[model samples]
Target: MSASGAKTNLHEFVVQENEQVAEGLWRMRCNTALAAELAPGQFVQVSVPADASHILRIPLSFARADARSGELDIVYAVVGEGTRRLSAMAVGQASTMVGPCGNGWWLPQDQGRALLVAGGVGLPPIFACASMLAQTGVGFDVVVGAQTASRHCVGYVDELRSMGIHEGCDCARKVVLTTDDGTLGMRGFVTQAMENLLAEHTYAQVYACGPNPMMAGVAKLSMSKDIACEVSLERMMGCGFGACSCCNVALVDGTQALCCTDGPVFDARRVQWQTR
Candidate 1:
C-alpha cells in the first residue's frame, strides 16, 4: 500500500457529538458520506489541532462506522494537547483525516471459534471488527477489560442497557468485562478473564487491540496454547496517512512496518513490543 493522501470528501468527517462514554473515554461520531465503506479492524487517522499550544495530528482508531447513516465513531481518551483540542471542538466542525488505513482485523475463513479481545481504549478497533464479523454469519466471542466498569466503551452492555449497535448476534455469545479496581464487572485484570476463557474453550483464532502489556500478555498465552492471534498497535502520529513516517515500528522479522501502511493490525507473534 502507498501513503494515504488527503482527498476531498475522503471520509473526512464532521464531529456530530463527542460524549463521555467513560471517565476519560470520549465517543466521537463523525458525520461522513462514506461511513458505509469502512469495515471492521480498519482505522482512520484524524488530524487534531492542538490547543493554541502546538500543532500535531492525533491518530485514532475507528470504533464503529455506520455507512447507512453516514456516521463514523471513534472512542478515545484525553492524553495530550491534540485530544484536548478535539474534545473542545464544537459539533459541526470537521476533522481532516485519512483512512481505513493499515490492515483490518478480520477473522480467518475457517476460524472455528474466534475470540476478539479488547482493553481500555483498544476496544474501539474491536468494535469495528465485531460489526464485520456479525455480517459474515460467523460466531465469535468478545472480551473487554478496563480499570473499572465505567471505563468500558459505549457498545458494551452495562446490565440494563446495550451500548453497541447489534444486540443479538447469532448463538456465538460473549463473556467479558474485567476491572482492576472492582468498581464494576469482574474485579481483576483482563488477562485473567482471557485465561479463564481460553481454559474453558479452545479458540481457533484470537484477535486483540490494546496497550502493550495487555497485547503482549495475550500473545504469550496464545503462543503457549498454539492459538493464532493478531494485534492492532497504537502509536503517536503526525499524519494519519503514511507520509509522515511517524507511526513506523520495526517488526520482529527485522522488517519495517508503518502503522499507517503495513498495519495497525499485525499477527501477535510478529510484533516487537518495546517503548521507544
Candidate 2:
C-alpha cells in the first residue's frame, strides 16, 4: 500500500468470487494489487463489459479489503442492466476498475463512541468502516435499515456479530436493524433507530450512507443533537475522474463540488440539499 494520502492508479482486477447475498444484492470479490490501499468509503468504478450498450461504469464502494491478501470486495444491488451484467459474471472473469475514488470516512483520534447509519446498498462502505473500527478499541454502534428483512437486509450482519463474539467486544451487540415491514428488526426507518440510540448514549460522531432522504434525516437529527456527522453522497458519473462535470453538488457555502473527485463523502452540515 502507498503511504497515507498517496494517489492510486487504475488497475484491472480478476474476479475471484461473485454470489448473491440477498434477494437482489450480490457481493463480488476481486483480486487486485490496488486493494492494499483502498480505505473505507472509497469506491471503484466497474466497467460492465457484458453489456455493450452501457458505456459508463458503475461506482461501488468497498465492502472489504485485505491488503495482505490483495483482495477487495464490493456488495451491490442489481438495480439496472449494468449491475445485472455484473451479477451474472462468473469467477475468473476480468473487470477493469478505476478506484479508490473520492475520500473515505475520517476516523477520530480518540477511541470515543461512534455511530454508523446505513440503508440498502449503502451498507457496503459502512460495513468496511465497521471492520476498521472493530480493530480498534473505539466503541461503536451500527443502525442498518432496509425496506424488508428478506429482500433488503445485507447478509454481513451475522458475520459482524460473529466477529464481535470472537473479539469479545460489544460493538456488534449494538447493531440495530430496522425494516419498513418489521420482519426482523424495529418497524421504522434507521433514523428512528438513531433516535433511540441517541436517547441512551452520547457519540463522538456519526457516519451515514444511504438514500438521500434517509441521509438527510440523519443529518437533521445530528444537527439537532449537535453531534458531528458526515455523509457519503451518491451521484451519476460520466467519468469517475473529475474531468466530467456530471456529479456536481452544491455546498452550503454557495459553491459546487464534484462527487467523483472532491468527494463521495462530505460533511452533512455543509451540503446544501436545497441547491440539489
Candidate 3:
C-alpha cells in the first residue's frame, strides 16, 4: 500500500474515446483495469505516448470510474503542452498510467445534507464526489462555476440532477451554475451562489475543488459556518508518488504535506489559505 492507503499500480490503457466537451476542455474515456481501483478524489499519472522529451506523466483526476465496464472517464483542460498532447491522442491509442494515487473524499460524519463546490475543470472530481454521495444515499446540493458558458460541463450538471432523484431523499436537491462572464446561469463566482445556498440550508459537510483563491474562499465560508469541509487541491507534481517534494501543501500547523502521497483531498481547516 502507498502512503495514501490505496494500492498503486502501473497499468496499460487503451483510449476508447477522446473528444472536446467544452471550450478548452476535453473528456477522455479509456479502458483499463485501474478503473476498478480508483475512488473519488484520487488521481492518476498518465504517460503521454510518443513524447519522450516530455517525460513527466500528466497527473489527472477522473470524473467517473466503472468497475463493471472497466472504463474510466477523465475530463481535463488544455492548459499546457502536456494536456494539449493528451487531447490529440487518437482513439485506440495505448498508454501507461500509474494510479489509485492519493486519498479520496470521506462521507459526511453527521449524516445531514452535504454541499459540493467545483470551479472550472475541478468539476471532474466533484462529479466523482457526487457519485459517491449518491451511491451512499446522502443528500447533496452542488454549485459549479466556470469562466463562461462555453467552459461549463453541462453534462456533469445533468448527471448531478439525475442523482438527486434518489428514493432516499425527501427535500429537493439544488444544482446551481455560475459563470464569471455572465454568459450562462448565475452571473457571478460560485462563492456567490454558495452563499445563498448556505443561507437557505443547514449542511453537515462541504466538499470543494478549484483554483487556490477560489478554494480559499470556500474554506473560509465553511469554517465560519462550523461545518466540516474537505477540499481536493491541485499541484504540480514531479513524481506521482512521494519520491519528489514538488507538490507540497502548506498547513495551518506550520507543516507541509505532500499532495501526491498525503492528499489531493484534505480537511479544509487544516490548509493555510493564501489570499490574492
Q: For residues 6-121, write the lDDT of model 3, one tens digit per residue.
A: 58999999999999999999999999999988889999999998768999998999999999999999999999989999999999999999988998888888889999999999
Best by lDDT: 3
lDDT of each: 0.73, 0.84, 0.92
Best by TM-score: 3
**Residue 41 accuracy (lDDT) in model 2:** 82
Candidate no. 1 TM-score? 0.86
Residue pairs with clashing backbones, model 2: none
- Give per-residue CA lDDT, model 1, range 57-118, as digits (tens): 56677776776798888888998777777788778887677665666775675748778888
What's the best-to-worst order under TM-score? 3, 2, 1
Report the lDDT tens digits of candidate 2 across residue range 115-152: 99998888888888888777765668889998888756
Error of 1 at 236 (Å): 1.9
Clashing pairs in 3: none
User: Candidate 1: misplaced stretches above 4 Å?
Assistant: 1-11, 49-53, 158-172, 274-276
